[model samples]
Target chain A: MRHLASILLVLLLTIPSSPIFSQGRVLEKKQVALWFGIRDITRDSLANTGDLDFLNYLHSSDDMSEYQYLGVSAHLWFRGNWEADIKVAMYDDFAPNNLNIKAIWLPMKNLGFTAGIYTYPQLMNEFNMFHRLTDVGFFGDTDSNFRQRRVQESGLTAGLMIPFSYRWLHATAYINGGVSTLSPFTEKVTQKMINGNFKREIRYSTSHSPALFFFPEVELGADCFTFGNAMAGIRVRASWYTVNRSVDYGRVTYEWTYANPARNEVDNPAHHFSKFEFDAGFYLTW
Target chain B: MRISTDRTTRITVLISLAFLLKAVSSCIQPVFDFDFDFNKITVTNLDNSDVYVMRNDRDTMYSSAIAFEVTLSDEEFLAAGSLPKAETAFPGFTPATAMSPESLYHPRHHITALRIVTLEEMSPAIPAGSDVTGLFVAYVPRYSEGFLYIITDELLTMINRDFYPGEPSVSFQLFCNQDITASRVLFAITVTLSDESMLTAQTGIVNLLRAR
Candidate 1:
C-alpha cells in the first residue's frame, strides 16, 4: 500500500517537469519549491481507545507522536489568475502523508480557492489471532493457527482547499470527504485445526463496512525570508474528522463440551472511531 | 496560434487518457479461491463385525449393513423434515408428522416418521436389484436415546455401485443449533431385504462444529 502511494507521488511530481506542460510559458518565479518540516501530532477521539497500554503494544518502536516530513510542489500558470498545482509529501514513518492535486484560481493576490483529490493519515486496528478458553485449559495450545484482520480506510477523496492571508500571516483551511473501499473489509473469519487425522473448521461470522468521513483542517503561520527567494515558517494546525457509523462487524465465540455445551455462546465487540488532532510544525520552502 | 492549439489538444487527450485508465483499474475484480476438498466418509458393513469404519475405496466389499455416522444440524432438519415449526421448537421432542411419502410407502414396515438428520448424498454402489424399500436411518443420540430418520429409495439410488475410483461421495446437512451443540449424533442404515434378511451399517463419527 505504501509503495503504491509512493509511485503515485512520483508520477505526479514528474508530470509537470516534462515538456508536455511547457509548450507555451517557459518558467516563472516560485513555480517549483521543496519543503522540509517536523510535526507534533496530538490525535484524540471519543470512540477510539485512548488506553495507552493497548496502543503501546500495537505501535512499532520507531513510531512516535512526533514525526518529520518532506514535500515537493509544482505550479503551472495559465490564463492570468488561473493555475494548476500538485503537491506530494512523504513522512519519516514511511507513510505518504499528503497528496493534493488541484486547479487554483486566485482572483486577488491574498486569497485563492482550490479543489482536488486530497489524501491524509488515518489509524486502524488489525486483529491478528484468537483462542478459545476451554475447560481442558485452552484446548490445543501453540499448535492453533493464527488468522488476521486488517482494518484501514481505503478510497478516493474529493474536497476543497481555501487559502487566505492577513498581512504577514497566512492561513489555509481544507474540507475533504470520501468513501472507503477494498481496504480492511469486515467478513467471516475461519479457523481450521486438525484433531487426530480429521480436519475441523470453525467459522466466525464477522461484519465490517466501508467508512464515510469528513475531514476539516485549518493552519496559521508566518513566512520569513531565509535566503534569496527562499523562506521558512512555523505553523500550528487544528484538525478534526468524523468516521461515520460502521456496521456490526464483530466476531463471536462459543464455549463447548466434548458432549453437550455446559455453557453458552459469547459475542466479541468491534471497533469504530472518529478523531481530533492538533499539530505544530516548522517548514522551510526553497 | 498553431502551437497554442497543439498544447490545448495535448492537454485534452492527456486528461481523457487518465480518466480512461482510472475506469479500467476500477473495474478490476477480487479473486477468491478456497479449498473445498476436505470431508471424508467411511462405511461399516454389519458383515464385517470386527471392522468398525471401513474406507470407501475401489476395492472395498459391498455390504448390506450400511452404517452412516452423520452430523446433523438443527436448521437442516427443520428445513428438510416435514415437521411443523412449533413441534421442532421443543428440544429432544420427536414428532409424528415427520414422515415423508417416501418413508410411508415402504413395502415392509412403513416408517412412521423421520428425525433430525437430513440425507444429502449417497454412494452409487448398491446392488442392482435389491429391495431398498425398508431402508431408513436409525439416529442414536446417545446409548439409550435414539430416533428413526427414513431415507427414500430415490435418495438411496444416488449412491454409487461401489466406492469407484474418484467416485464423488454424498453428504448430509448440518444445522447450527441442534447438530453442532448436541452431545452426540449417530446415523445408521437399517436395511430389511425382501427375503426378510436384515443388514445394518453404521458410519464413523461425523465431527459437527458450531458456526457463528
Candidate 2:
C-alpha cells in the first residue's frame, strides 16, 4: 500500500514539470510551481458519544495511530484563478486515511469557490486500527489470524475561500460542506490453520459527510534567496466540522465459530461527531 | 501554435498518468482466496475377508470382502491430537444451495462404480453383461457453497441427502442374489471426491462358494 501511495506522489510531482502551464508564462499569471510541505495534524471529536466503542473486537498492535504529520500527500494546480488538486492520505500500514480531489474557481478578487469529490476509508478499521485502542488485552485482538481492510466513503464537497494578503503575511478563511454517495459493502473470508480450520470476516457500512467546516488560518514568511519565482512560508490552521453521522462499519472479528456467520448481517452503531483539526505547516513553493 | 499544442499534449499526458497511478494504488488489497488442499480417499475392507456367498435357505455366508469402507480425513498440520477431538467437533455443519444444479458446473464426486469380475477380466470399470456385473452410481450435490464439513454420517445424511460416498468411512455390501452361481470373484471400487480426490481399490481373488 505504501508503494502504491508513493507511486501516486511521484505522478503528482510530474505535473509541475509538464509544459501545459509553461508557454504563456508570466511571473504572477502564468507560472509552474511545486509546493511540498510538512504538516502536523490533531483532531478531537465533539459529540455526546455513547458507551459504544468499535475497538472491543480488533487485534492489538502498538505501531498504529490516528494522526500523523504530513500524512496526506496533496497536489495543487493553478491557471488564471482556476485550480485543481488531489490529496490521498494513508497510514496504519498504508491502509487508508481518506482521499480528496477537487477544483477551485476564483471568480473575483479576494474570494474563491470550490467543488470536488472525496472518499474516506471505512470507519470501522479506521476507528479500530487508527483510533480505537488495541492494547486493552482481550478486547483489542479477538483472533491473531484476523485482518481487515475497508474500501471508502466517497462523496462531493463544495466550499468558498477568502484570501487576504498584507506584504508577507497571508491568510485564507474557508468553509465547506459534503454530501456522500450511499455505499454499503460486506466481506467474508476463510482462513487455513494448523490445529484447526475456520472462516472469518467483517463488514457493513453507511456514512454522513461533513455538512459545514471552517476555522481561522494564517500564513507568514517571505522570499528568501529566490526573488520573483520562489518563496517559503509557515502556516497555522484551526478547523471545526459540524456534527455529522457516520456508521462506517462495525465489529470485525475472528471465527464466529467453525461456522461462518451470515455476511452483512451485523450493523454498526451510528457515530455522531463534530470534529476539530489543528495543523501547523511549513512549505516552500516556486 | 506548435508550442501551445505541445503544452496541451503534456497536460493530457500528465492527467492520464495521475489517474492511472490512482487506479493502480487503490487496487492493492486482495480478497477471498479459495484455498483448499487436494484430498485423498482411504479404502478399508477390514480384515481382508474378500468373499460373498449365495445360500438358498440355510446359513452358508459370512464374509468381510463383500463390504468395503471408504474414509477421507483432512490432512492437518498437527503433531499428535485426540481422535475426533475438538473433543470439540463442534457437532454441526452448513451447506449452501446452488442457484442452479451444481452438476452443470460443479466437479464430479461419488463412487464411480463397484464391479465384480472373474479372474480373467481386468480390475477396472468393465461393464457387467450376461456374465459381468457392477454397481455404477454418480450424483452431484445440490449444495456445495461449502461451509464447515464435519465428517459424521448423521450430519452428512442431512446435508447431502442420498449423495454417494456419504461419510468419511461408509460400508457397502456387494452381493447379487441367493440364486447366483459360486465362483471366485474380485471386487473393485473407483471413487472421486472434492478437491480432485480419487481412489480405486481391488481385492485379490477370494472364494465365494463358501465362507472360509
Candidate 3:
C-alpha cells in the first residue's frame, strides 16, 4: 500500500508544471487522435450469477477478461473552455466496442458535461467446459457432443468529465447514466457422432431489451512529446458499466427432429451483460 | 465571416449526428431467443409392444411348449427374414400354418439364422416382483427329428426397459445362427420370487411350415 501511494504521488506530480519560459506557441485547433491500447475487463458481484459459472470451470482466476483495441477521436475546440469530440474504438478480438459523440463544456476549466451514444459490446465463447459427455465403454463407437455460449451488448451514455491537469500531466474521471440494450445473445450445443453418419445442433438466446445503466470511467496519463506538428501521450483508463437486473431469461429451442418431434421450448434465466474494463494505450494527436 | 463560421459549425454538427446515428443503427441486429442442437438419439421405448413374446403370455400358458410357425418361399427360406416385433401382441406372431414356398425343396433345418425378441411390460411401469430372469432357446428340426442347437448364455441379452417412445417395460433379445428346418423351437423361461415360495417354468414353440 505504501508503494502504491508513492506511485500515485509520482503520477500526480508527473503533470507538467507551468512553462518556465513565458512564451506561447500555436497548436492545432482541430485535431484527430489515434490510440492503441490493451484492455482488462472485470465483473463485480455479477460473477456470483450462475451464468458465469463457466468462468470458474474454465480456470479463470476471477470473472475478468482482457482485450486490445484501437481508438480514434476528432477534437474540435469551440469558444472559451469548450470542446466537441467524436470518438470510436474497435476491439482487436471483436468488432467495434465503443462509439460516441459528445460536447465537453469546461465552464470552470476542469469540470464538464459529456453526453452521447456510448455502446459497450462484448463477446465470450467457451467449449466443452460442462460435464455433458462421460466416457463409458459400453458403446465404443457412439457419438459425443458439446455446449458453448456467446453474449453481446450496446448502450447510450451521458456523463461528466472532470480533469485534473498539472502541466503535461493529465487525469480525467467520468460518470454517466444511460440505457443499454443487450441483444442477439446466444448459447449453442453441438453433437458429433463417432460413427460419422448424423449430428445435432441447438441455440438459445434472450429477447433483446433496453434497460437503464450506469457507466463510470477514470484515466491517468501524461503528454509524451511534440514532433513535426503532432503530439503524443501515454494513457491508462478504466471503465465500468452494467445493466441493473440480476438475471435475464430467454426461450431455448432445438433444431433436430426424428420420426416424431420432441419437447422443444424451455426457459433459461441468467445474468445480463455487464463488465468493468481497464486499458493502457498511446494516443497520437495530429 | 461570422455568418460563414456559424454555417460551417452547423454543417459539422449535423454531419456528426448523422454519423453517430448510422453507427448506432449498424450495431443493432436481430436477437434470437434460443436455438440449440443435440446429436445423440436414445430409445427408451419399443415402438411395437404387441408383436413380441411377452412375459405375461408365457406365464398363463399351461403346456410346457409354446409354438409359432412361419412358411417362406424357397428364396426367403434360404435368405434372412423380416425383423421381428413383440410376439404376444400379434396372433400371427404365434404358431401359424406355414404356406409352402414356391420351389419347395425342403432342406432339413433350412433357416440359416433366427432372431427372437421378447418384451416384458409391467403394470405400474416398474420392475416385476417375480420376473422371468432369462431365456433358453432350442431348435427341434423336422418335427422332432433332431435337436440342432440350444443357445443360452452367449445369445440371450435381457432388455428390461424400453428405449424409445411407446416401448414396453422390459425386453430380451435372442439371436441364433442355426439351420432351423425344425417344425418347432422351444423356449423355456423361469421366474423366481424373493420369498422363494413358488418357482414357475414356462415353455413356448415357434413352428415353421411351408406356405400354401
Q: Compared with the true structure, what per-residue lDDT tens digits does model 3 show for residues A9-82?
A: 34323312223211232212454455665544444222232232322222123434555566665555555677
| lDDT digits (tens) for residues A1-286 of candidate 2 | 3455467566656655567644346212322222222323232233323322332322223433334434333334355777665565554445434555667788887888878766554333433332224232113222344356544445677888776778766666666676654255443333322111122333333333233333223333343344566555555555554433434444444342333444232333434443344455554556
Quote the positional error of residue B184 for candidate 1 in Å. 14
Q: Score every model by TM-score.
A: 0.40, 0.43, 0.42
Error of 2 at B58 (Å): 43
Q: Which candidate number has the best TM-score? A: 2
Model 3, range B30-123, lDDT digits (tens) per residue? 2211111111111111111121222333222211223222222223322333223232342222223264222112122212222333322222
How would you order the candidates by lDDT, starting with the best? 3, 1, 2
Per-candidate clashes come to 20, 5, 55
- Local accuracy of candidate 1 as per-residue lDDT tens digits, B99-192: 3222111122212222323232222332323333333333222221211122343233332122211112233311111112232324444433
* Pairwise TM-score winner, candidates 1 and 2: 2
Please list, in the order the candidates appear, how each scores on TM-score for chain B only. Answer: 0.23, 0.33, 0.21
Q: Could you report the DockQ of all the candidates, in the order they appear?
A: 0.01, 0.02, 0.01
Chain B TM for prediction 3: 0.21
The residue-level lDDT of candidate 2 at B36 comes to 23
| Model 3 C-alpha RMSD to native | 27.5
Better of 1 and 3 by lDDT: 3
On residues B92-183, what C-alpha lDDT tens digit does candidate 2 reach at each position?
Answer: 33122353222111113433333333343322443232234332111112343332222222223333223322122233323222222344
